[model samples]
Target: MKNLANNVGVSTIGIATFFLTVVVVVLIEHFTTFNIFTLSFFIVFPAGALICGAAAASGYYFGALWLHRRPTILIFVQILLVAAIAQFAIYYGEYRLLDLGDGRMASDVVSFKDYLDVYLSSTHLRVGRGALDTGAVGNFGRVLAFTQFLGFIVGGIFVFVMLRVYPVCEQCARYLRILAKKTQLFSKQEDFTRFYDTVFEVPVDGPDFVTLMKWQQEKDEKAVRGTIQSETTLRGCPHCKTQRISQEIKVWGEKEFRDVPQLTRHLRIPDGIDLTSAFKTV
Candidate 1:
């Protein structure tokens, strides 16, 4: 439960930041004419939505990765929450700045129904609808709201597809880190055929060298002739419990080692040349 909250919290913060940025940019454009710069309001909303969507998607992806959980439902819920918060902020900010003189707060002006109506309206989707039809003088508010909502959905899908292709374990309900990995090898030979195999395992740490040697010996004794193997690994976890072990096998090869040169020849220090002077200088 704590892990789930943490993931949601991270995503919320990310979405909030994106929302704030978009609201600020929109406010700036609303107050001033970017006409001098030839930047269209139409371009601004879609581009901002795309950028915000991408940012939110990244937040969801990393949050799920950290918690080692599938993000299907989580991402959807987060997007809805973000959309609500962003709509409120955008509308409230606009009301405070523009409609306060009309004796209505942003909260009073915007409602869930308004958002729903905008999101569901198909008028904006018509091919014949031009900028004039959807401009601020027309159904521009609905169009803007819908575009941003679409951005969030598109962003979530992008992250979902990417995660599916590069899969990770979603069994553990808590955040996890790689603990340890070990490789075990096995082999067999026949007069008419030959085969080699490798297996991997994650063993709890604590057995002494002698105990491990004995265990290896026992395993070897029970194995058929020509079956030889070695194991190597390191492991740890925040909860001090083993979480996962991953393994891969390749053809065996001869052991290799690197030779070290003696360092004694390079260890000599100058014989008390300036010990007293060096200490005084320090």
Candidate 2:
């Protein structure tokens, strides 16, 4: 149970962060010069599934608890509970910001943020439906700009919160691969890595992957002949759940820090494998 919560909780945080990022990234792509891949990864990824998966995992973790308490559809019930909770949070945030304490609707017509463009870029829009833009919030753009600044700070904090609370899916992945290699137990370890990398490697598309190994011939071959290394990164998500694998650039400073052989703890280089396939995981 502890393990499941830790696993799902951690995954939820990472997935939510990446998923939430899609909104900002999409808006950026829409307003800037970027590629389709960038837009797809940055904008379209549904991070909510991580939350869903976590909730499901939680139910599974407490197998007897759920079965004894809720029985018929225990896991499904837990998932619904989480869904309700998430919806409540999003709705509460929206209402807290937009709702006026009168018997009236919000100043904004619709919610779901589809009208961000209309709200943010609206300097002096000429209207067709009315003489002036009824949707206008005076000095709203400035307000939005300020909010955007706040959003980054909030997002940063949220990301930190997620990283701290969760298992650091990327980090956990390092150990999983190392363990897999050390055990050398599975027949399709190679296929597993390819799929796993697609799932965990710096994603370009959700930036994606699952089924650890599918038994395809190409996937099989790629594993056995692949170059190996314990890849350390914070980058993309492909088309599956992601582990944002970016390059960990070491920053220099005037005060030299001690090299205590400590930083290596988080990284692992497995033994008795192709050695080259460490990164690729075949």
Summarize candidate 2's per-residue lDDT along 77-109 as a digit string, tens digits.
Answer: 443344334322333333334434575545355
Highest TM-score, which number?
A: 1
lDDT of 1 by residue, 33-131 (tens): 221111124443454555455554465566565555565666666654554355345445544454445887544766645544543353332223353
Per-residue lDDT of 2 in model 1: 78
Model 1 reaches what TM-score against the true structure? 0.38
Candidate 1 Cα errors over 4 Å, as ranges: 1-45, 56-58, 99-137, 160-282
* Model 2: residues with Cα > 4 Å off, grouped in runs: 1-45, 52-72, 97-182, 185-282
Q: Worst 10-residue stretch by lDDT in candidate 2?
A: 35-44
Local distance difference test scores for all models: 0.43, 0.34
Residue 269 of candidate 2: its Cα lDDT? Answer: 21
